[model samples]
Target: MAALIDAIDVKRKTTFELEGVPYYCLDADISSPTARGGQTLVRLRMRNMLTRAVFDKTFKASDKFKEPDLQTIPATYLYSDGDGSYFLDQESFETLQLGEAMVDDALELMVEGLAIQIDLFNGNPIGLTLPAQVELAVRSTEPGVKGDTASGGVTKAAVMETGLEIRVPFFIKEGERLKVTTETREFAGRA
Candidate 1:
């Protein structure tokens, strides 16, 4: 028997199968029962684990759902080739390649030797989970003019080692390490 999940726990990043299709919940808008004992329901926004298409759904009461056969594996980032980025599974010692389209915005955070969690469905790579924040070195940025603090600490465009560009304080410069939030691709602070 498969593990089951309560409807309320079905939020962002939660995986389950609906009508035999695997999906990851992106968000849920839950409406509680009214004073008159109105029906409670939860509206869900979810994505297809395979096709990456998004859809909306609604669940009532404590709808129990069978958890999909999804597995999380530790992998090491290798390098991006013409087709996609390469990774090595730490446990199985096998290499896997995820297509560029599959990685999406994660390409901005990927670096050689970075540890990541890969989501696998039926033994196939489906998605990735990166560290909440990562330290990446600034590859290049325009030099800040002296006394530029007068601009109320204006931000300038800087490129990271992985080629992701972000607005950073002028005081930052080339060859500096910056802590960046992977989810938003925003600069958190100096590393």
Candidate 2:
């Protein structure tokens, strides 16, 4: 039997069907807003339960949903090679490889052997969400000193080992590990 859920409960484990296809949408919002001009808009964050694809859509507040069955599974990050990204099923001990296209925006935050939770439907992997923070090493950057007041306060452009560039504090150096926020890629602190 299919499960039913309200739009407000979308963030949790819930399901709904659209055109006969089941989908699990997470961290979604469905609400009506009153604007300055007295106009109203409905916003939504939806993920395809089958494909694990996410998208935002706006609709009239009058619309409603019919629920579907939602399931959850635990997965772990194995490794990534030129071939593709791989994950190990915690419960089944099965490993699966996902193409670059499947990872989408989450690719930029990946690190070797990092474990993360994945949303799936009917045994197909859909979306990859990473931790809020991650630590990485600096690969290259110009040197900076404590008393260097020549460039504003104190900042340096450092390239992470992953090849992503970030503006770090003046004291950071090559090979030094630093904490970074996955959402903004901003430097958090020295690790």
Instruction: Indicate the TM-score of model 2.
Output: 0.71
The alpha-carbon deviation from the true structure for residue 143 of candidate 2, after best TM-score superposition, in angstroms, is 0.5
lDDT per residue for candidate 2 within 120-186, as digits (tens), equals: 6556776566778888889999988657776665778999877788898887879999888988989
Q: How accurate is candidate 1 locally (lDDT)?
A: 0.89
Error of 2 at 174 (Å): 0.6
What's every prediction's RMSD, in angstroms? 2.7, 5.2
Off by over 4 Å in 1: 5-13, 30-41, 59-64
Candidate 1 lDDT over 1-191, as tens digits, reads: 88888887788878888877688899988889867968778888999988899989889858988889889999999988788989999999999999877787798898889999998887889878899999899999999988889869599999999899999999998999999998888899999
Per-residue lDDT of 27 in model 2: 51
Best by TM-score: 1
Clashing pairs in 1: none
